[model samples]
Target: MVAVIKSSASIKNVLQYNENKLKQNVAQLIHSGNYGKDTEQLGFTDKIRTLEKLISLNERTKLNAVHISLNFDPSEKLDKETLQKIADTYMRSIGFGNQPYLVYQHHDAGHPHLHVVTTNIQRDGKRIKMQNIGRNQSEKARKEIEKEFKLVQAEAHHLKQAYEIKPVNIQKVQYGKSDTRRAITNVLDVILPTYKYASLPELNAVLKQYNIVADRGKEGSQLYNSKGLMYRILNDKGEKIGIPIKASQIYNKPTLKFLQQKFLQNQTEKQRHKLRIKNAIDFSFVKRPEQSLQELINALQKERIQLVLRQNDKGIIYGLTYIDHQTKCVFNGSDLGKPYSANQIQERCNQQMQRHEQKLTQRPAFKHANEQKQSALTTAEENGITFKIPGVKEVFKELIQTEQEGSLAAELRNDELRRKRRKKLHH
Candidate 1:
């Protein structure tokens, strides 16, 4: 089983999240702790009043709400009773057994997961120390519960689902084709909690894969000034379409402020996965030494690592962001090191192309001799006996240039050179 623990200032938000899910019939209140009646039988007001009453004991603890989720492998066939017991045991192990927490069994995703909502404030007006709770207590409890229940271990479970990111097909959110709010929300529900991205661009690199983009509006705009955010669907051409969904309106409230916090948290989280990307890139090159830029992209994609190239209107690639699906990590090329940066990647591709080009152009003395003989054999009447013997090398060179100069790859190379020249002039 995998576990995620989060603390929030608004217990209502946490409660309402589950409440909304319950209303949608995607979740059910499974068990209650430290309550007189079963949690499933309690009304919304009763559940809120009971938890808030305890939170009011300590005004100093603004973030009193604790939300935890225990995720099981998709193959696991866990009944409600077993899930409740697992939640109960996991909570007790994490020192939340005495708290008036409620467990809700969620059936939204492909996996079997349970959401536990509770408070950290005690009846005596004392607040529980939540620092390192997830890394320390929750991890310990998750492993223990997995063993006790004979369930899939976290490491094993992740490995099992590593390369297979989304088992069920989730079509790209197209404007007007579906509910915009729900479509973006569904994408966020899967992305926000899973991928580790430090910045909006890095996050967007992953979001663009699902045809969704998080828009903070233009600089100096009202939304930008107010630090507001919106999620919008992108068309096949990558243009934004349809009405945008406010970040706050989303179920988990992935606001700009919220994402800023995540940016900090994910920076450290993303570091551990950098080596995986670096290795994958190096391996791709090793696998195909003569591969072009497009071939490299294909090789990386085959490994479930997306190599997103950021290019200008001129089609000059200026940036590279790698998305590792297996590890759920997004990393900029610069973050990986100088070798993986945009400049280096372009230089490498050009050099590889140059090498292959050289190999194809290089000719031994015998070939040159044969070309001279063939040139001599040409007769004026036969349409060969050149009026002025043209150099075979120059003839072939012009033909190669004619073939390459107008090619798409050559245009990209030209843009890259022009960009580099512009930078040089500016510097």
Candidate 2:
């Protein structure tokens, strides 16, 4: 579970995003802590009006907006009532019930999430005390909610799964320098409409026709690649333009056979290209001694390092190497070309050796620590103990066990759960 909070100065613009849809999905009135029944009777618009009225009534500062989102991983098979209870508990724990807060359950995304909007100013015309609250309060809320929900606590700096569209750098290509950027731009533009169901073979065929190649890997059963290239009959903005068709649905050729051949060919070509360039550079360097500096310059130029020459009044020359956008070291011409003194090289090698040893030492230590942590967590979970963040909620095995026991009510929780479970079972 993840909780994100955002503060706004205006409620009008914030709620205006999907006002109509939100209005239609207001589930139940859990609890309104400090505000009155009349205040509760006022709908969202009227609530905003009431807030304004309260501010005017007291001659206090105008009310600003406070928004919070609670995202939960419903993988634990929780029922609708339980889910709502959890959501309500989360809001209450975060100090929203005592304020003018409106909770909305959003069903637009793949996961079940809730959004809460409130005013910083209370009905008594006093602003909710919020200072240095960003980091501390958020962490506190997250910990409490996790414990209450009995969720598997995530690490402090856990690596989140993210979808990134990186440009593929192709060698021996005309736009080699800009190939990645150009490829990303072109692919995004061309394939944006038809990427959902494009099979590996069909994608490869289509890319081959346009001099592009589609790579494939697993995306939770559906195959995808780094490019996220898919074949869908969607319009430019991802709205359904027509029905989508898979490669197998459209083509008669064997998908696996063609992909195997193409993968082999691509790998072979890449290896050959790398070898050819290395050989050419080595041959050129061997043939030209006077142009050694030029060759070295050419070789290192590809790495984005800057080389500067310095000459004294006596005509003695020296070279400086700049790495990491800073001047690293200066060396004489001879030292720059040939290997350094035994002591100098030894020092450099020793530094590298120390780093290597440090890495070697830390790797196993980290691995052991992680293994121990996981083992402890597994044991605790089996013992029905809850693991959670420091300040957020703690989720006990009892909650999960109770949820699982209510499997009959799961069907009525949400249509999405049924669809997802069906898809998982089907695949």
Candidate 3:
């Protein structure tokens, strides 16, 4: 079992966050410790008020709320009772036994995890010093509890998922270059040799989360030809800051040579993840058939795959890369298939645009035809023509009027002929 903890100043926010999961139906309140009632007896609002009242005792500490999540192995299928016991024991072992903490079982992720919401402040208003609490207290408790509970021992491979990287504020790092270097180093130390990436852009997509970039000079430049690379801290805008640090200067020596070897190895190692990347891409298009390139990128990002577009100097996209962060696999778009290639994707985007534009243009023609039909019906009513006959009533009315006029002209000719004969006889 792995324990992850985060501290916040707002008790309401942490309580609402866990309760929101309950609203989503992906979580359940399993155990309420040090509370008057059982988990089933207490309502969500009551739970929040209970924790808040405890935090109110210590008005001096701004960061009083403690949010901790304990993740078990995906292979472990512990029942609610077993999970509750483990949560209670872990809390007591970590010295939060007396504090009022709400235990919630979250089912959103693949593993069985529980979220504990409690405050560091005691009922007597004394603050629990949380300095090194995670390293000193939580780590020791996690090991002992893992053994006692017979849970899967969290291997090194599971460490990254257990403890996520904390993001550094880019704006703050600008004040000191060493802080930027140290921050970059901290991230690279974990990601450089671990995550399988084939190219620089794929690596950047992963580094982007930590506000760091591994940059090679412009194409055909001395640095690019020499296969030299440098690392730089990226600001909020994604622009580089401070002098670029050479890869060789870093203790790990993440040079181009080192990265190239990783690229070659990743080519073979990342094959296992190709199906997952393909499925994610296919699923995105199925969900939103008319999605633009940017929309597709957003959708894939939710699936834990970062799609990076490679463009030329003229701003024409020539290639595509997908960084599957979940599997730590990097694949070139062409490597996936011709369908995932840049040209093919651009074609799909164009087809979607054309379909949308065609619909927009066809709307006016359809509206005009409907309007003309309505106008014809209104004119027929104004001219005393009934349209109930349905078989071209206007044409039938014109034919009837022509026949009646011909018969009347013939009758008037006959009367004129009679009048002429009578005048001749009188003369």
Candidate 4:
């Protein structure tokens, strides 16, 4: 199964663009929370549109929107089109079309999945209740979809059981392996219902609170109480779900602390990477080669691109152009600070333009434009507009004369009617 979540606030715009077909196939209202009577009475279209609008609003206010869609795997006999039809029918069963919602099948990404777009708002213009409603509804919907599709309940068996493993140490213990395992086991069984510990330390704390001691082996003066040892935690089904392992195994094998530190470090690296991307677009101090703002905008527009300006800590403006969805190239905006020499500015502009043109050539649009031009020429000839051939000239001339006569006749009738009106008034 695959899942997708999206939230949007542009219900009207999205529906109107698609001709409102989304609101027509809704089967039923599964659940509505917090909006009271107004939401309860909303039809499928209104409900969907309202929710979509709310999602958009939520994105604007919270800088995030959440949507989730899931589908079952198809059997061997079913092809892609069959799988999509099944997904669509399942969506309809869940009231997808009756409300203002969008459901899309994405088969490009390995597995077949559905993309559901919904609003976070109700008919009364209030935000959906956030009391874990999303999680709860998703779980409920998943089960129903699975049941409706008659999908096999894929097994949750653990491959770790195939190996005979021994506990390293009971003392110098972090959380007792057995109890930590049981706690995790219970969590997986859905007994706890809230398992938010994404890190080893947090998991360690939970195990400790449950009176579970976690211990690791020691070597010389070094205690092997690293984060790698925290992998013993199991859910009620005895599945190794919330386990953390270290990258290094033989040489200086990972401990629980090392694993935790690595996870945190990796998270920090990811954050830094995202920040760098954002800064490239918004930082002011990043120097652009030396083009004026107008010149930069013109260059980007010529290349079918958009420029994003960012202010840096030094109060300098930096301009970065988004070349595509996944790539951005930076330019120097320092010319905004002081008057630049004509030679320096001209050289910078030329360099920037060269880079931008080179980037554009690498884009899909370059090839797509060529194909489109070729197709347009073919179409023109098929319609007799490309009549450079000797034999087709007579046919083209006759067609043009017919068109001109039709136009002249329409004009003459208008003029004669106007003259008749003028003479009637005089009489």
Candidate 5:
């Protein structure tokens, strides 16, 4: 079992997240603690009002909402009773036993997980201390609960491939419809926090998978200068079709300023994942050498890493971005190191092209030489002439040298040019 906890300033957003899922029939309210009525017995306003009352106890506490998820291994087939018990045990162990909280069982993914929503503000108008709650208290509680329930230990189990949320069907999100906005929100909510994307375009790559894209109008537009960003739903053909929603207006506040902050934070946070990504790229090349840029993209896709190659208007490749879903990190190729940088990758691709061309150039020459030799032998047999089959060892050596000289020289010149380019890139 694993626990993911985050504190939110708004309780309504967290509650609405689960409530929307419940409306979709993908989640069910399992246990309602401190609330006099169960979720189904109360309306939406009542649910929010009840949680709001608890949050209102401490007006000074800005970050009052605590949203957490307890994720179990897919191998564990836990029923509702077992899940509820785990939630209750986890809450009480983390010093929230007496707090007002609600547990919802979410079956949206392959694994069984529960989303728990509560307020840090207690009934006594005092805020609960949440500093290092996950690292210090929650980790201890997780281990104990796993041992107590004989649950599958997270350390002992290797999680299966990640399950990404399915893209929304384009036909369902008609223009000027609420479903379009809701569909876009559902995708963004799941993707924005989960995936590690550094820039707006990198984030859009993942968003495009869900028929959504982020736009900044045009290059010199007023919106672009202000760093304003908007999310638009796309059709099946990837053309924009719906009304664009400003980034600031979104529930999660995925504004340009917000994303820019995350970009800087990710720079430091993603260092630990550098080696893992490097090894994955190395393994990819070992499995399939001489891969073009497109082929490399295809290979990395199988590893659940998106390779975004940036090119100039002249079609020269200049930048590379690696988005690793497994580690949930984003890295520029150069950020990882020089070997993984854009220029180095282009050099590798050039080497592939050279090797392939060399092979193509050699095959025909060898085939033609063999054909000449066969013709000579046939003539000697048919004419009844006594002709010695001369050993052309020295001749063949000279032929190979002559045939390879130009290709080898070209390869040498290319390597020299690449070295110069790398030097410039470093400068």
Candidate 6:
């Protein structure tokens, strides 16, 4: 089994995410730890009030909410009772057994998994220290639980792959075939906390890649003036389809105002990856000095860096965002440096394009000029006259269309073709 823990400032947001899953019928309340009522008996308000009461006890404890996912091998078909037992034991081992928490069996993946939502605040109003809890307590608990239950070990599991936190498989998300709002919400659940994008467009830059987008509508429109944001899914053609889900309706209420706060915070948090992105772009150019813009984009992609070039309807690029999948960071090109700005990168691409076009246009003309000269020399040679010009004669000597050279060339060509055919056959 594999375990992952995430801390959030709002238990409400954490609870809402899971409950929303339950409402969609894709998740279930398997076990409610330390709650007065059973998993099926407890209501949403009851669950929220019970956890928030302790959190309210400590005013300074902002990050009290904990979201933990326990993943099992896809081949392990554990029943509800077994899953409950394992979850309870894992919680007790990790010191969260006594806390008011909810365990949900999520059926959104290829494997069996449980999402536990709880608060770290103790009943006595003291906040439980969560720093390194995942690396320390959770790690210890996971290994023991695996051994105690005789389950498949994550390191040496039969599947040869460990289940971890992964973004939704966008390719499988078809509109009407799957739950639309739930799919979009699941995307937010992963992306909002994972990627550091400061603004709406920056956030959309990451979201759109997953076939989701956050829109504030046109300027001065009702939704825009009200500072409202809606997340909509895009089709294969990148057109918005189906109904749009309001940002307020999603987990954590990722409203325009909420994003403004993230913008300030991410502006600083995303700085640590600047040098990494710059080095990637610099190395791409150094690898091949004469590569075109598309080639440059492809090279960066090989390094897990995505260069997003945004253009207007007129086909003029207006913005650039570099998404580094390796670091899980996104940055507007202007934020990196002037050299990486849209205008400057466009300038570079334009120069490379011009050079490429020059090569294409000039090559055939040069070849044709040589062919004309060669033809004139061949005609003179066939008339029984020596074709000679001062410096030009020596330059054209090897290229002369002589009978002997033609037979020798044919033999060499036949030899090359034979070698190619033999190589193909051998392969």
Against the reference, the lDDT scores of all candidates come to 0.81, 0.45, 0.79, 0.41, 0.78, 0.81
Q: In terms of TM-score, which candidate is stronger, 4 or 6?
A: 6
lDDT of 2 by residue, 300-334 (tens): 44543333333356744333322211111122223
Model 5 lDDT tens row, 209-233: 6889989889999999988998888
Model 1 lDDT per residue over 1-427, tens place: 8777776767898899999998999999988899867766798888899999999999987568888878888879999889889988998999988889888999877788888999999989999898668779988998888889999887884645642334112243332455678767656766876788999999999888888899999999999999999998787777887778898887667888888888998899779888888888888777777778889899898889999999998989899999998888998999999999999987888888888778644534334544544553454227643436558646755555455444534555776899999999999
Off by over 4 Å in 6: 2-10, 16-28, 34-46, 58-64, 79-82, 88-98, 107-110, 122-175, 349-427
TM-score of each: 0.70, 0.35, 0.48, 0.26, 0.61, 0.72
RMSD of each: 10.3, 31.0, 23.9, 30.1, 11.3, 7.4
Better of 3 and 5 by TM-score: 5
lDDT of 4: 0.41
How far residue 297's Cα lies from its native spot in candidate 1, in Å, is: 2.5
Candidate 2 residues lying further than 4 Å off, grouped into runs, are 23-44, 54-63, 74-77, 156-427
RMSD of 3: 23.9
Expressed as tens digits, the lDDT of each residue in 1-427 for candidate 6 is 8887776777888898888788989999988888888778899889999998999999877567889889898878899999999999988988888898899999978888999999999989987887657778988998998898888887874544544333444455542566677778667766776678877888888888878888899999999999899988887667877778897776667678867876887888889999998998888767776677788799899989999989898988899999988777899999999999999877877876788667744654445555766786778679876645567666555555454345545665777899999999999
Highest TM-score: give the candidate number.
6
lDDT tens digits, residues 1-427, model 3? 8887766666776787778779999999989899888778998778878878878887878668887889888888899999889988988988899989999999887778999999999888898887668778999988888889887876557754655675556767766635665577658756865578887777887788788889998999999988899998887877888768898766446778767766886777878889998888888878887879999899998998888887777889999888887877877889899999999988987888789767744664444544555676678789987767767776765565455445545655776898999999999
- The best-first sequence of candidates by TM-score reads 6, 1, 5, 3, 2, 4
lDDT score of residue 298 within candidate 3: 93
- TM-score, model 5 to reference: 0.61
TM-score of 2: 0.35
Tens digits of per-residue lDDT for model 4 on 295-365?
65555444444444434578454433232112222212232222222334345567766877687555554
TM-score of 4: 0.26
